[model samples]
Target: MKYTPVQYKVNATILIKSEKSGMLSELSAFEDLSIVKNNNKEVENEIEILKSRPLFKNVVKKLNLNYQYFAKTKFSKRLVELYDNTPIKIIFKEDSLIVDPFANFIISIHSKNDFTITEEGYDSIKNGVFGQVISTRIGSLIINPNPDYLDSFIENEIFLSIKPVMDIVEDYKSRVSIGLVHQDANVISLSLNTTVKAKAKDILNGLVEEYNIDAANDKNQIYENTASFIKERLSIINTELSDIEQGVEVFKTSHNLTNVTSETELFLERSSENKKGVLETNTQLGLVDFMNEYLKENKESLLPVNLGFSEESIIRIIAQYNETALRRDEVLKSTTLKNPIVIRLNEKLQSLKLSLKQSLDNQKKTLKIKLKDLQRQDSVMNAKIASLPKKERELRDIVRQQEIKETLYLYLLQKREETAISLAATVSSAKVIEKAYSSKNPIKPKKRIVLLAAFMAAFLIPIMILFFKDLLDVKIKDKKEIQKKLDIPIVAEIPNTNTKGNFIIAKDDRSIVAEAFRIFESNLKFLLSESNNQTKTILVTSSITGEGKSFISANLSIILADPDKKVALLGLDLRSPKILEYLNLESAKGITNYVSDKNLNLEDIIINLDNIPNLDIINSGIIPPNPIDILKSKRLQELFVKLKSQYDYIIIDTPPINLVADPLLLADYVDLCIYVVRLGYSDRELLSVPENLYKNKRFSNISILLNDVNINSKKYYGSPYGYGYSKPKSWWKF
Candidate 1:
């Protein structure tokens, strides 16, 4: 959520700050070379170190961040971080608290030292005092009073909590954002969300301080390691120098050694050059030996490259090896050796190591040949200066080696001093341009934005529900809706009238119901196309019984029969008949009686009504046990053939097509099928049944009729077609 939840809100939550950090790219002669160059990567790396888990865990441990203390002030409901002003201290074992990371409870301070837990546990700790350890449902804990706030907050509540430390660490990690002050610049901008002003300052400042300490320590670590190596070597070399000096002293004392005589001075001078060469060769050889030993001992560590090796190429190769090793170490800090960057650095280091050892081998071999040549020259010079005693010559040899060891020892001493300088001058990665500060208001759950969002949701919810309700409604709503769903052409949309009687059509009637039937009569000419040589046998059926197919049929018969057109209203819906009920006739003799007996004819079942002169009603007669069997009889077809010659239009009302096959059996006799669908009553799903019948050509033609559309409803009827006449004065006048 853009507006995060407020439950995790703390005091002084929004912190915005910036600082300039001096990220050390490389330490050359203890110089901070990063200031002049664009070391953007080092700046990013320092920021990462600031947020590292190890560093964050140090902060957590220092501040005891896992246990949070909060209390309300006298003026506000907002809980502020008690921080150093906590009334009571909570003591718990980390191991026990880890079992339930969210052990949130309250301590009610009745007095300075006395308190009780508002939320008790199974242990249900009794009232305890300051410094008293009591067992609770969460774990064993103690409440210690603050000497400063003890008198200030009595009969007051302190809300204490132990949040899961690891999760909180991650939450802060995500919450604290780092940005560059400008592109390719060393300065960094840091922002963090926290509630307490002091806590915010501490977190931001603590992070920068720890980062500086860590960076400084890392820089010094290399120099310290180098210093340690030089010290160890100096000790061994010092001991060697002492032993050689002692041997020289003993040899000279035993020989009573003297200086050169006049004749042997030139010989001694010539020999001195060879002795100096031997000393220089020995020193280089000793350094090579140390290098070989170092390579053999350390499989994965930095080598001391600044050790004064006579071979310049050897020093350069070792520098490359050490640099690669340092890179590998940096990679290892964030990930394991399985990382590809670490693996590649490992491979490069191995190659450099091989090159370093080869260089040492070639230099050591050259030094040995030079030393052997120097010894041969010295032997020749000694023969020329034969007057000198042999004991004196032996004493000089001892003294020469002692000088070499002393020189090497002094050289390591100088290197150690340089390393100490580097350690002392290790620079901090960051310089605080400005200490961390906070915003005037909190960042999340902005009141104005949240109020706007809530207002929008409140207004939109009801409208969306109503829109979906209308979209997915299963019942047929109106004529246009049915037209959109089905392929059948709607012949007429009949409006339901206010009259209580079923029959509405009359001579010169101008009611909306009568007008709707007149429109249906006119549409029949287009529907009854194949009725040129025969009566138009129209079958009125519906998907279900309550769709007003029978009511529409009787009204259509009266409208069609205008003295020029003879219309027969046949009641063929033998099961659950409604035509006789609508017309108010007591004639029991109907189609069923005529169809079963040969003595009864079609004329016996059909009755003429005086109100509608040309219209005749053929009732359902007696309810039959076998309506389907009666409709299937040969007499039914013969009856239809006889009626086609006498009547110009035959309106036959059959049983609902969805309920029985009686309508389907008469499919051969009917010219057109009027499928009646009642608006708001008929199910939209039933339109598919009629569609399937039309597709299979079960009826020659099927026209749709929407019945019972409310005349006054603008949504469905959309303005009735005619102005209706007033109700009759007496009920039966019309």
Candidate 2:
């Protein structure tokens, strides 16, 4: 047997697994090659050559492999010698004609030996005695077996061991038996010979029955079962083969590799040796072809065992399949879907068809009636238009008016339709709440907002009350109010002094309140100072009862008696003599007796007070029903002229202006008039009387005094005379 030594080198690029990212080492080297080609040229050359082939190109295309390189370097010679010193080889037996030299030796000798030297002796040598034969052993013996050479032997042994067992198991002819015996003398007293004889008989009978059953089933039945199974297996194999072929074709078409070989050939024809040429060729063939060819030629010995398509190739195949499927779906969608215009047209057509059908029904129902009405109206209009002159201007005007009315009616009908639609579309109605309430901020008092609220209240309260009174009724209340409303000045303001320490007759001048009486004194002073008349007697009256007539008369008389001036107070209201009680003086004879008696003189009836040096008082002598008639006599006017040179200032308090006629009648006698207006006690409406008397020029002189004023009232700062007023403190420290 002859054998040829064939050396197959596999460039296994093994990479150590990195612990950090669970990946193979980035740096790897091929053991067979010193200079690693980590460039596109190697991958491109492989891809181009493989793409030119038919069978391998289709498989490469289906696998979708890619060519990728890693940097490689050779170890130094010294490093290689130190680390990789051992030479590893495998030798195996082939056919006799191709025997391996290393395996053909039956015995391997470790030491050199001479072939001529036999074990017994060298004298019995046939051809050349005493000549030594060189031994052919070159190295030590080591037990090594090649895995490729032992594969057939190992597979054959496995098949042989499993085939018969599988056949018996499938045929159901295999059986298992167990034998049992009691050998203890204490437990079983039977002899050993008896026990063995009984067990042997049972075993012999069981084995004979099983063998007879197998023999009766025969090999023909087994052959028939085996043939049936083989036929089924062959059918499945054929089906699987057909499916694999169809899958291959599908993969080729999906990856665009059906004509890869022809395409690669064409590419190589146009290819140049430049970088652009190589890159263009590789791009045309794709990554799969490049990697497949690289693994095949560079690691051919390891191809069937360890090499396969890379992960990048599988990803490319899946991506391409998905893209193709998506495109197909898009095409199907565009072709099968209905157009929007067609759908809208169909909907409108259906609606119009329904409307047309309804119109036909309506026409059937109303044709006769409508035709009769139209004929009658047409006849009437035709007769009317025919009666008009053809060129007449009035006819043209009539026609134009008819046309305008017709157009307006049509326009109104259309507008009515639109309005109906709008009304139907409206969802809600609006309601008003309070008509906006005049939209003004009411003016109210805010003390913190302003410092003048108190001042405004003092003046505004009285004005507002009067305004409100005017709104309620037209009656007058007081002479001063009437005067102010009528825009006239007051005639007088009598001072109110009715206390004991300030007590006086017509001549006393010891009261401090009497100082207030000087205001009236000053008014009369100015009045008489300007006037030529020197009348001293004055009649005081009021319009009603309790108008302070006596009080005013007494205080006026006391105020006038200053520095030896003579003055007297007289009770002119003969029906009610309040002067005696007010002055603390008792009189047996008063003004009535004095006036009625013929011989009465001023010294006979006048009473004097100790404190007032020049003042005196005259009480009304007796109560009389008709004091007016007595006062009206000529003696009274002559008596008033008789006291003309007696005093400097004289005053008379009369009945209220609204209640009596006496004050009005005596208006001519008095040289000066002083009106008293009591705050809060006097009615504001009665003020017009005094005001009107002053406006009519009925008094020689008139002035007003607000009486009984409370100095502690909130209206004033501290006193009625404006004393003790102070500014407010600063706010920051508080």
Best by TM-score: 1
Alpha carbon lDDT of residue 527, candidate 2?
56
Error of 1 at 38 (Å): 16
Over 77-146, each residue of candidate 2 has an lDDT whose tens digit, in order, gives 1111101111112121222212112212211212122112111222332211112222322222222322
Q: Which lDDT tens digits does candidate 1 get at residues 1-734?
A: 33243322222111112222232234443442211111223556555666677667667767778888877756655676777667677787655544636776777778865887765244454688889877766677777778888777778777777777677678778877776677666667767666566676677777777766766665565676677788888989988888898887787678777674666666767667777788788888988998899789877767865677788899778767765665577557668888988889899998998998899999999998998898888878877866677776677567667888987888777778767766666666566776777666666667788889889989898889988988888889877777787788889978777567676567887877778788888898877865665678899999998899888898888888987989999999898888888888776798988887889977788888988889999998788898888998898888888898899989999888998888999899889999999988898888898999889999989999988887656675355443755443477754
- Tell me how many clashing residue pairs each candidate has: 9, 49
- List lDDT for all candidates, in order: 0.76, 0.41
Q: Best-fitting candidate, measured by lDDT?
A: 1
TM-scores, all candidates, are 0.65, 0.32
Task: Report the Cα lDDT for residue 604, model 2.
Answer: 73
